[model samples]
Target: MPQPMGQTGGWESYPLNPAVHPGKKVVFQYTAEMEVKTLVFTLIDKGHE
Candidate 1:
């Protein structure tokens, strides 16, 4: 499911199900009223630590 970023867009996070493995490709679809300058992705270790 895609979540809306709302009118005031700053930062939003989405979790990947089944996780992403090596040799896999992830695609994102974004719609914004204004021009998008930068997009960033951060990986978090949810495994046993």
Candidate 2:
């Protein structure tokens, strides 16, 4: 499993399994005390194989 680098906000990139679906929706779960101010999900295209 890939762990989050830390609890700070910035740009992050992770290598995902190729089997993962492209249209899947990601969810972020946090405690009431900690708030998720922003979330940016991006998918880069390398062109068709």
Candidate 3:
């Protein structure tokens, strides 16, 4: 779920299953009252380098 951080929209985080295959497709759905300026997605690896 998306979380409201402040006036600048919000962020959401989901834990991917270890068995999830690469190149998997993801879909996001939302409604906004105003024109969305920007959308960013980031993936972080928490395992050891």
Candidate 4:
């Protein structure tokens, strides 16, 4: 099941899908009126070795 949303943060973006490689730091614009945001993701595991 999907976890709760707001427990996290403002906006979010995950990997396109399960990826073989680790994650990449992501930053994008929400709206021109709003400020840009940066998200850094660290791959803890690949669904267990």
Candidate 5:
């Protein structure tokens, strides 16, 4: 899913695919006019480890 960013906001969070498995390559893209300051991948496991 391509989550479009607003012009005024500096941060946003996009929901990851539930079917996403390990070793999958997720691509994050933005427009040329948009400036990317930082990128982070967060994984939260609430189930049994």
Candidate 6:
């Protein structure tokens, strides 16, 4: 089992993959840079898991 690095804004704490739970995972985080549209894409990519 793996523990969390720390608290995050929910999605950032979700498992990179839930079913397999391989523990091999990829994490991505980026600032909106005050751009809302760019943040949308970042969230879209997160759902690709």
For model 4, how big is the CA root-mean-square deviation?
7.0
Best by lDDT: 5
lDDT of each model, Cα atoms only? 0.44, 0.43, 0.43, 0.41, 0.49, 0.33
- The sequence of per-residue lDDT tens digits that candidate 3 reaches over residues 1-49 is 5546555455444444547633232323233533444444434442522
Candidate 3 minimal-lDDT segment of 10 residues:
21-30
Question: For each candidate, what TM-score against the reference?
Answer: 0.30, 0.27, 0.33, 0.27, 0.41, 0.22
Comparing 1 and 4 on TM-score, the stronger one: 1
Q: Which residue pairs in model 2 clash with each other?
A: none
RMSD per model, one decimal: 6.7, 7.2, 6.0, 7.0, 6.6, 10.7
Model 3 CA deviation exceeding 4 Å by range:
1-4, 21-43, 46-49
Error of 5 at 18 (Å): 0.9
Q: Which stretches of candidate 1 lie over 4 Å from their true place?
A: 1-8, 21-35, 46-49
Off by over 4 Å in 5: 1-9, 21-33, 45-49
List the candidates ranked by lDDT, beginning with the highest.
5, 1, 3, 2, 4, 6
| RMSD in Å for model 3 | 6.0
Residues 1-49, candidate 4, lDDT per residue (tens digit)?
1222343334444553455544433333233334434445544454654
Span of 10 residues, lowest total lDDT, candidate 6? 34-43
Worst 10 residues of 2 by lDDT: 23-32
Task: Tell me the tens digit of each residue's lDDT in model 1 across 1-49.
Answer: 2445666333344555544542233334345653453454434453522
User: After superposition, which runs of candidate 6 have C-alpha atoms over 4 Å from their true positions?
Assistant: 1-13, 18-21, 34-49
Best-fitting candidate, scored by TM-score: 5
Query: Model 2 lDDT vs. the true structure?
Result: 0.43
**Model 4 — TM-score against the truth?**
0.27
Record all residue pairs in model 5 with backbone atoms less than 3 Å apart, i.e. clashing: none
TM-score of 2: 0.27
